[model samples]
Target: MARISYTTVSPLTHSLNVTKRWTTSLGIWGVGAGAAALLFLSVTPLVRREVLVKVPVLKLYYEDTTPASDKPF
Candidate 1:
């Protein structure tokens, strides 16, 4: 018959390992979230300004060509 030896892990060591894994995953997620937030903040103003600049053009396209006197309001 052959004898097999099994290694046992301590609870504290297991907990520490779990904590380390969670910390690493959270750290990576936090960095990604921060980068996304920064990108959004940086792009938001530019997008808003661009939309603002184009609003008059859009309004012109949609504006009624009929004389104001013909309008009901």
Candidate 2:
């Protein structure tokens, strides 16, 4: 009978990372919204209103001047 010898293997280790928390201030968003509102108010009057004019179609052909050779059957 032969005796078998087993060796213990070491486990792998991973590094842990820590990140800082990010935050936003309300002043920037408020100023941006205010500027956008001011720009929209200032540009509103520059846009012109569209007006459509209806016109009648004119036909300028006489039936009496039709040639016999060029007339459609």
Candidate 3:
């Protein structure tokens, strides 16, 4: 009778491979999130500012009415 033992890949090798994959995935996710956040912040402020500026602000000058104001279309 003979005792037999078998081992596959080493535990250290498996853990290192797993770590490499996890880091790679995290790197990709971080870049994607940073880009999305930048785009959102950059575009939202510009759109809001444009909208704010477009709103009509009427200033009535009681002493400055001219003939152009009298002409009606």
User: TM-score per candidate, in order?
Assistant: 0.43, 0.27, 0.41
Q: Give the clash count for each candidate.
A: 0, 0, 0
Q: Give the TM-score of candidate 3.
A: 0.41
- Segments in model 2 whose C-alpha atoms lie over 4 Å from true places: 1-24, 44-73
Give the winner by TM-score. 1
Which residue runs does candidate 3 get wrong by more than 4 Å?
A: 1-5, 8-11, 43-73
lDDT of 2 at 19: 18
lDDT tens digits, residues 1-73, model 3?
A: 9999987999999999999989989999999997677557644646435443354542231122557868674
Candidates 1 and 3 compared: the better one by lDDT is: 1
TM-score of 1: 0.43
Candidate 1 at 15: error in angstroms? 0.6
Candidate order by lDDT, highest to lowest? Answer: 1, 3, 2
How close to the true structure is residue 65 of candidate 1, measured as C-alpha lDDT? 72
Better of 2 and 3 by TM-score: 3
Q: For residues 1-73, what per-residue lDDT tens digits would candidate 1 score against the true structure?
A: 9999999999999999999989989999999997677557644646435543366755464344779899888
Highest lDDT model number: 1
Q: Quickly count the clashes in candidate 2.
A: 0
